[model samples]
Target: MKIVISDYKSSLNFDINYAISYLRDTLGTNTEIIVYEYNGNNKEFIDILNDADALITGYLEIDKEIIQSLNHLKIISIMATGFNFIDIQQASRSHIGVAVNQEYCTQEVSEHVMSLLLALNRKLKHYTNDVDAKGIFDYGTTNNLIRLDGSTLGIFGLGKIGRSVAKKAQSFGIKVIAYDPFISEEVANECNVELLPIDDVLSESDNISINMLLTNENVGFFNMEKFKKMSKRPYIINVSRGALINEDDLVDALDKELIKGAGLDVLVSESPNLDNHPLVNRDNVIITPHSAFYSETSILECQRIACDNVINYVNGNYDKMFRLINPEILK
Candidate 1:
């Protein structure tokens, strides 16, 4: 078996010896897999991908052209849960099996969301930066930071990680309400979360946390209209996919003081494009480099499960773990 791993970099900046070792072991005993440093719009990647038996990718986009060119391709393994980049319909037509790393980093993502929620609520990011600059920053001077206990936490989606976040919030004496239509009322109630409409969640929340994967229906879903509907000064946090919220509109809302503040773990990043982006200068707006799941525990789980999913399928048993996209291919 031969596989091509794209969007992988071996820069002095990133340490990825563990991932390389995992791939080598998974495709052990003369099975060949080529790993290439990512340089977008390269002919080398196109050439390598054409002859691949399977492919693993990080952040690069794979369109219908790439899918159609992969005559030997059997699988498209995404390191992340969202298959937004893959042309799923095209992969299906090409008989390419799609498996994503779904269960890994579940706790890390939840923890990061919790961190952002607490950080924003307590004005930790603002004052921490201030203290670092001035040598002393007061608690009362930054803003009126509030306590989390007895406050309302509105969860956008109540999947695995969402439930974990809700449970953590509940432990802090925060009331949880969610807006996941797929989850049964009984199941949500068991988790001690009130199932409510999107609007109601926006209206009543002290903090609005987004934990949903982006679907075609929800692309640019949180727009100006939704921002306008928010009442009672809710802090917004998104540790999920980036496209779920419009960056431009969010800056506009913040500029107009429509929302209280935003704590982002992931955003659409094209460095120079977003360098002078409106949210950069604001102390209230916090952004991370799509790194909600960068802890040691999370990284190890991602390496283990991603390699296992590909290895298991290659050995003839599909993982029932958490297949997100192209389930029929496994059949």
Candidate 2:
């Protein structure tokens, strides 16, 4: 069997050698594995994927064109939770199996969200930069810092990571409310969070954290109108997909003092022109390079689980493990 691992622009330094060895041991000696460091945009990738039995990708957009070009492709597994980069509908039509590393990075991402929340609430970024760069010794200049206790935290998506964040926030004496249409009120109550409508969550929260997956329905959802509805001027933190927030409107809200600030782990573009981007060089804003999913352990676990999903699927154990994007392909 032929397996191709597309390690596109990966900074995790994933243990590809270990994955290769594991698959070889599980599949057989005849297994051929190709590891490519470049992205899927090149003709070279197209040439290689022509005969691939399975493909594992990192941050590579696999569109309909790429799907149509594959000759013997069985499965395309993404190394991240978000599979929006892949055209799932196109893949489904092509009868190509798609899987995502869904269970990984839950803790890492939740922790990062909490870190950003605390940093914004305590004004850590402002004071740390002040002491190190401006020789300022006074915290009074940053007196806008608020206490997390007795404050409200609104969660946009009450999925696995959202529940973890809610529990952590509760430990800090925060009142947690969440909005997820897919999740029931009973489910939210079990997680110790009040289920509220998006509008109510927006107006009532002291801090709003986005924990939802990015879908076509939610792209640029937090635009000027949504920002205008935020009655408390809440601090917005996004550990989820960046396109969920409209960057232009976010900048406008900050400029108008309609919102307090923002902490973003992901951006619409991973590599933005820093000079012109309004989110950068701002005291109230904190930006992380789409790295809310990184940790020494999470990286390895992600790599392993992604590879294992393909390993199990091709081994004819499709019904047991793995998050399948198109289950009908298995039938």
Candidate 3:
């Protein structure tokens, strides 16, 4: 069997030496393994992937046309939870199994969300600029600083990372409310989170954390209309997908002071043009370069689990696949 690992070196800065050794040890030394680093030339790497039985990737975009062309591919294992980068439906039609490492960076992401929330709430950027940039340090420079102990934190999606955020927020004495159509009231209550509609969560929360998964229907859903509903002028915290919010609407909301501030870990475009990017270097916006899911431990865990998915599928141990996105392909 032959396997190709792509996009790991540049996209994720991950070393797949462990994966190569593990696959060779388990599948036998004769198993052919290829390392293909994507260099923005599809034709070059497409030739490499054409001969592979399995493909492991971090951020390579495999669209419909490419999926249809790779006739030898049996599985594509992703190193992250979000699979929006890949054409899963097309892969399914092509009888290609897709797997993801769902829980690898849960702790890192939740903690990053809290860090952003706390920094925004306390005007960390404003005060830091005041002192560092202008050489002035005064407590009265900024006002309306609220205590997190008595404030309400509204979560948009109550998935694994969202639940972890709720748990962490509670320890800070923050009230947790959530808007997740998929989660039941009983489940919310069990987590000590008050379940509410999206609008209600917006209006009532002193801070709002977006944890929703990106999908075709919800792209840019959190626009000016949603911002206007935030009666409390809540600080927006998003460690989730960037395309969920319209960047233009978010900038307008900030300009109008409709929302207090925003802490974004992701943006609509990962490689946004910084020369004219509206969100970059704003006093009210703290943008991290989508690094919320990074940690030494999590990276290794992600690599191992992703490789395990590929290995198990190649070994015909289908049940051991980490988390299959297109399980029907197996049938």
Candidate 4:
């Protein structure tokens, strides 16, 4: 059997040696494994996967043409929670199964969300820049700091990460409210959060954290109108997909003071043109290059689950593959 691992970016700040070793041990000597750090050539990408039996993709998009070209491919495992880069329907039609690593980085992401909240609320970035570059020790210039205690935290999605964020925020005295259309009231009660309508969450939150999946229904969901509904001038934190918020609208909101500030880990384009990017060099906005789901431990665990899913499927142990996105294709 042949296995391929593609799409390795250096800036993610973690080595894939552990994942490689794990795959080596699990698949054994008989299986052939090749790892490719993708260089942006569409023809080269398709060529690499032409004879692939199983694939592990990083941040590459797997569209219909590529899916159709992957003749022998039985499985495509994504190293991240969101599998939006893959054309699920196309893969299914081609009888290719898809899997994602959903549970591996929940703690890492939740912790990162809290880290952004704390840093933004406390103005750590602002003061650090002020003291380092200008050599000015004046801390009184920016005084938008507010006590997190007794403040409301509105979560946009009540998924595993969102629930974890809520639990973690409670320790900092934040009252958690969530809005997830799919989640039941019982689940919200269990999470100790009041489930509200999306509009209400927008209007009432002292600070907002986005934790939803990126889907067609919610692309550019947070626009000028949504920002205007925020009565508290809330700080917006998005550790989720970048397409969830309209970048231009977000910048306009910051300009008009409709929102207090933003902590964004993802952007609409992964490789954004920084020269004209609106959020960069701003004191109020914090951007982390879509790295919330990263850590030494989390990356290893995520890659393991992603690889194991394919290995299980190949070994006729489909029951063990926990995060299969296109399970029907397995049959």
Among these predicted structures, which one has the highest lDDT?
3
Q: In candidate 3, what are the lDDT values of residues 1-331, reduced to their tens digit?
A: 8988888344646666878888888888998988877777888888998889999887678999899999889999998888888998999999999999978999999999999999998899999999999998898988998999989999999999999999999999999999999999988999999999888998999999999988888999899999999999999998888889998999999999999999999888765677878877887889987889998898788888988998888778988877999888777
**Residue 212 lDDT (model 3):** 91
Q: For each candidate in the order shown, give its overall lDDT on alpha carbons.
A: 0.79, 0.87, 0.89, 0.88
TM-score for candidate 2, please give it: 0.95
TM-score of every candidate relative to the true structure: 0.93, 0.95, 0.95, 0.96
Q: Candidate 1 on 145-228: residue-level lDDT in tens?
A: 778898999999899989999998999999999999889999898999999998999889989999988888998888999998
**What is the Cα-based TM-score of model 4?**
0.96
Query: Which digits, one per residue and each the tens of the lDDT, describe model 4 over residues 8-96?
Result: 46433466676677777888866777877776777888898888899888667889988888888989988888888899999999999
Output the better candidate (1/2) by TM-score. 2
Off by over 4 Å in 2: 10-12
Lowest lDDT sum, 10 consecutive residues, model 3, at 7-16
Ordered list by TM-score, greatest first: 4, 2, 3, 1
Candidate 4: C-alpha lDDT = 0.88
User: In candidate 2, which residue pairs get closer than 3 Å at backbone N, Cα or C atoms, i.e. clash?
Assistant: none
Q: lDDT of candidate 1? A: 0.79
Q: Candidate 4, clashing residue pairs?
A: none
For residue 194, model 3's alpha carbon misses the true position, in angstroms, by 0.9
What TM-score would you give candidate 1 relative to the actual structure? 0.93
Give model 2's clash tally. Answer: 0
